[model samples]
Target: MASLKGLGYSGGMDIAQLKAFPLFAELPDAALSHIARGATPLAFPRGALICRKGEFIQGFYCVLEGVVKLAFLSPEGHEKIVDLVHGGSSFGEALMFLDRPCPLYAQALTRCQLIHVRKEAILPALDRYSSLARQMLAGLSRRLHQLVLDLESYCMQPAAQRIIGYLLREAETHEGQTREVTFPVSKALIASRLNVTPETLSRTLSCLSEQGLLKVEGKRILIHDVERLRDLGPR
Candidate 1:
């Protein structure tokens, strides 16, 4: 773990950067500026540990650039990737509100720039701005719903189906009949998230390629037949 010795407050982050995030998009400039002023920008190189499991939640974190992986370590020392937080998204808000320790570890999947908004700054703002509180609740609800869906996928879906579902979900973000997707994280991490072995994930990708549904080129995957790929997963 790298020390935060050289980490200094970033002057570049302002109201505009806060507005880029959906949670703060509707906030007035004054409010956004308040939040921005409270933000501490921190950069993490790939594989850097942002927070470890059982650590106290100090503030809410937003990914300004790059990706972060939330994972948990089992008693046997195996790690399970729970979720991936992308740019423009905020995390740790719920835990901060509850004043609880983080249940999982957060690690930088790539070189990342993040803004940490201290709890003291957010709680007062939440009271001063009802819209901010509502937005936070809505975001927490959506995260809960996603967790439910993940539970269903893990319990009811097969490994290959889960992989197919993951691919199809990625494809939906693009606007086309065919889509190109790239894994920002390692395949082993993805396999852990999908609850499958790395070899199983590789085999599933090979099968999809053999069926002419997709083409895998290193970390990039080209989905040749979107409909066929969707058919392999749960509707």
Candidate 2:
């Protein structure tokens, strides 16, 4: 098991970055500074299990850097990749307030840096900072809205469209100005997130390539026509 590190933020991060998140947007500088003071930074090796399902909640975790996979493993031992959380995104927040066991596991897909926030410490911060409460509510609401969108896509869209839609959204949100979009996760992992078979995913990608929509260079996808891919999926 990897050990947690004390909060020793080497080069100071601009508190403004947290402000970009609606959950931390309203937090006053002093309050943000306080929370930042209390937070612990931890390192995770690639493929490390950061948190396991059903484990007692230690605290809420926020990804400070690198990617983390939020997933559920089946009784038969199959794992489903649910969400790939990026930097600035948080997890275990909703569960921190809930009474039930966590239904999912969180794993670091690469060497990652994370911050831990103890639940017991949250109320005082909220009391001292009205903006913190507002930010938390907004963050939670955005997550809920995203879940609804995922549900709607699954129920109302066909498989091809669903896959394409997801890829396009991913493409748009992809960082940098480069034409080639690198898939951070493996194809099998991506297939699991898309709720499709690996073979099916390959076939679909081939089909997309044949239609001149994209060029697959290993894990990187060079999107040839964004509008066409957008049109492939249901609106």
Best-matching candidate per lDDT? 1
RMSD of 1: 10.9
Model 2, 136-232: lDDT tens digits are 7777897788676555434433767767877787787777444467778999998888898888888878877865679988898888888656645
The per-model lDDT (C-alpha) reads 0.81, 0.73
Over the stretch 147-196, how does candidate 1's per-residue lDDT look in tens digits? Answer: 77556444534888989988988877766554988887999999999899
In angstroms, give how far residue 82 of model 2 lies from its true place.
2.2
RMSD of 2: 11.0
Q: Which ten residues in a row have the lowest lDDT in candidate 2?
A: 1-10
Clashing pairs in 1: none
